[model samples]
Target chain A: MTLDALIQRLRDFADARDWNPDHTPKNLVMALAGETGELTALFQWLTPDQSRQAMGDPHLRERVLDEIADVLLYLTRLADVLGVDLLAAANAKIDRNELRFPARQA
Target chain B: MTLDALIQRLRDFADARDWNPDHTPKNLVMALAGETGELTALFQWLTPDQSRQAMGDPHLRERVLDEIADVLLYLTRLADVLGVDLLAAANAKIDRNELRFPARQA
Candidate 1:
């Protein structure tokens, strides 16, 4: 499924579970951090190859994916609640960066 | 000032600039990346001390602080618009991380 579709599904899932209320910017940030930790757990000190091969277990893959999705979903919801056009803000920042870091140096 | 106060002031600044509408998740993400680049520019290949010393110039310090604030403001706006409680979310994420990366391992 498309990313947008997946996000929608995730949103719906949250809404259905009445979990949306707990998704304040503060809460989402915490949740995102938690999920990031989960993602990190998959590769604390493993070799690069071992980390890459983490998807070997279907169940484990699903679990990891779920945590990652949770992070993204909460972030998306955070953006929505704050009335942010993340894409536009991001592009503007890029322009600033180009000025700050010239291509020659980069 | 407190972080909350600073954030509130930032929101006011963005609102005054008519920039909030453009802060969609995508735009904010892009803006964040750009600001990150700016932050990175001050330290490319430089020693940590040199990077820290770059703040010697008051104007430069202001510029750097402004860029960093911009990144955070956009992110906060993104979260606000999306209804995410960033603090709560962050805390949740930390908890998840604790589970994923226990203290001994971390």
Candidate 2:
């Protein structure tokens, strides 16, 4: 599904609960931090190699993906509420990064 | 740009810097958490109304968007490095949420 479609669904889900009033940027960002914290916990103790292989097991993969799904959902919701065009902002940031971190010559 | 396109560009940017060894899931998730923390700080003290109006000021808007851009970039990188299809996972989660929170009859 497209980002727009997913955003619409998320909005609908919240609206059904009459949650627009509670989905303020402050609230959303706090919720987002909590989700990110949980996500970090999943990979926190793993060594680099174990981290790379951390998702090999179905159970761990599901847990990791679940957290990721939460992270992205809140992130996109925050962007929408802030009137930020996530794709455009990301593209612009990358454009700046390309200049900031130019390729080193071989 | 589509998420896939942005993801590829992110990968290219990291690869140019020979960042693969360092971009382990653990590192990426930690990085993501840092970005999310920065994003949270932007609105941490704002009240709900102030937070809603946070981006109205052009200067504040730019700073907020920059953090969000960073947050999304690290998040997508973590997903890519872990082989998670962000869109699919998000959609699946929404599907589950829909079941969990049905619309109330008015």
Candidate 3:
């Protein structure tokens, strides 16, 4: 599936739930942030090494993947509403970073 | 810049700071979660409408963007360490979602 397809699915999901009006950029961003927090909470008490091995637990991995999915869905929706192409934006961000923190120079 | 470039930059950033040892998948995920929390905190008390208008404040917008960059950076790094292609995984996820939440059926 392409990003376009994902965007369409999100639109359908929102339309089905009559959430279009509420799925504004700000709301979506907030939701994305919330989901991110949830994802983090899953590993809140783990040591760094423990966190590294988190996915070794099937249930924990499943939960982590679900939270990741939530974050991605909200992020894509927010970008779609704002007319931002996530892939392009991500690429552009990398370009900017190249200048700000030159790898060779660093 | 491509995703590969971004991944390289992340590698460089970690290498420059001697953070590679600490950049385990778990550590990266934890950092990502922490950043997400910070991002959500920015709009914690805001109503949905207020969240939508969040970027109208220049300072707030800047902070939001910074947090977003941080999240994306960490996400990409996490994916990299885990040998997952962020774009491909995202696409696969959408494909699965299409089956789970059929647009026309929904």
Output the number of the DockQ-best candidate.
2
Clashing pairs in 2: none
Each prediction's number of clashing residue pairs:
59, 0, 0
DockQ, cand. 1: 0.03
**Number of the predicted model whose lDDT against the real structure is largest:** 2
- List, for all models, the DockQ compared with the true complex: 0.03, 0.83, 0.34
Across B21-78, the per-residue lDDT of candidate 2 in tens digits comes to 9999999999999999898888877889999999988988999989999999999899
Residue B1 local lDDT, model 2: 70
RMSD of 1: 15.5
- Rank list by TM-score: 2, 3, 1
Candidate 3 residue pairs in clash (backbone atoms < 3 Å): none
Q: Could you say which candidate leads in TM-score? A: 2
TM-score of the second chain for every model: 0.70, 0.96, 0.92
Residue-level lDDT of model 1, residues A1-106, one tens digit each, is 2324434554555565566567554444445445545645544555544444555667655554554445455555544544444344444554565466444321
Ordered by lDDT, highest first, the candidates read 2, 3, 1
Cα lDDT of model 3 by residue, B1-106, tens digit: 4557778867767677676788876677778777777877777788777777777788986666666666777887876776556556566666676678665532
Which is the winner by TM-score between candidate 1 and candidate 2?
Answer: 2
**Residue B33 in candidate 1, Cα distance off native in Å:** 1.7
